[model samples]
Target: MYLVHTAHWQFLGLTLGFLAWILTMVTAGLNEWRLWHMDDVSVITSGVAWVGIWKVCFYTHVLPQMEFCRRISMSDSFLPVEIPVAQVLMALAVICGLAGSISGGVAMRMVYFTVEDRRNIRLVFILTGTLYLFSGSCSLVPLVWNMNSVLINSTIDFPPEYYLPVVPVRQQVGTAIGVGIFASILMFISGLMFLCYKYARHTLRSVAPRSTSNPLRGPWTTTAQRSNGVNKGSDNPAFLSEEVSC
Candidate 1:
């Protein structure tokens, strides 16, 4: 018999995990952290800058001259002083999540393992669920670290004229941060679902009835018994069989 709840939860986990992975990849790659507006500035000379985790870009004030936008170079001294932590974490999260999804997908349904070996399926589920949880944790760490960095270091450095008139208001939180946070949460939830499914599978298997007949034993046959009867008292027999009454 098939386990309905296990399959349901596993399917849900895979779906949500894949969706979260897509969001993670998109948010990590895009450069939409900030939007800029220019007030009474000419397009030819005046420009507005936008910053993201990966790079920074400066664009002309005029909408028609957007093609003139240029990316600022990060390698001023021909080397980066620090590693790109955000990029690395997000990449690893995606990779691990993908592997977990594949394993979990295979483990949910046991079409290959014979009835005698079905117990091994639970082990696969446990392993995949653990990997998924790890992936979720990895996704969360980077996002929380980035958020903390932004909160502590976001004090206004530019002159008052550059931003809104509010004294305490510094920078606006970008869409990417929100998306990343949501994705991390979803990933965590998906991992939990997979784990729960694995537990349920184990519980079901433990309580299932065991068949008494040995799976390795072949069907009973009268020919073997007849051979044993003819060779009764011999030291060695051509065929092996259970004893038959005369």
Candidate 2:
């Protein structure tokens, strides 16, 4: 019965999230290929693929049956129950996950161009890359923690045999917390790299030369003419000797 109440919305949200993830991945991949000349689009592509596959598995194979039991749980209520708060939270997590992944991909590309200092660029890449990884990981928590399952199983209205194997709530909460911590660390590192890059560039520009003399402006001949103060005809033997010697 809980599934009846939550499955449709949950599936809809998941479907939207999956499609967005796919789009972001494709866009990021093509952009990377065109701009960076690096051939490792697979790293981000694989994450999107995994999430999409999992979403399909949940929607087609798992949710329908779960919905049947959920419907039974809500039959007694005359008024449609208000949407579960958990569903709202899950939707937010999915959005954040997608955004983080896209941002991280862009940051990774930035690092490739920022490679004048390997240490600084490496730190930036790690930070932004981890932010995406953690965000995606956090998105899975809501799907896994479907609290509706626990409520339905605990109620006597649902038969014991019909109880579904819900993911433990503790596990879901733990995963979300872990990802949050990881993302925070990544953010800190990214901020540090940005500051360092700004400072380094500023220092370099301050001391660099504004202009340089041209080497091919006839320095040798100019010096000779200036010292002699008079021009000798090219036909003269003295001019020929001077030209040959100097």
Top candidate on lDDT is 1
Candidate 2, residues 1-246, lDDT tens digits: the string is 011222233223333333544433332222111011112233222111111111111112333333121232223332123213323433454465565445444444443344444344435434544444444444334323333333332222213332322221221122223333344334333333322332122233355665455677534332223336776533546888999999
**RMSD (Å) of each candidate, 1 decimal:** 10.3, 18.7
Off by over 4 Å in 2: 1-83, 113-156, 159-202, 205-237, 240-246
- Indicate the residue-level lDDT of 12 in model 2: 35
- Cand. 1 TM to true fold: 0.60
Native-to-model Cα distance after best TM-score fit, residue 135 in candidate 2, in Å: 5.7
Q: What C-alpha lDDT do the candidate models reach, one value each? A: 0.59, 0.33
TM-score, per-candidate, Cα-based: 0.60, 0.31
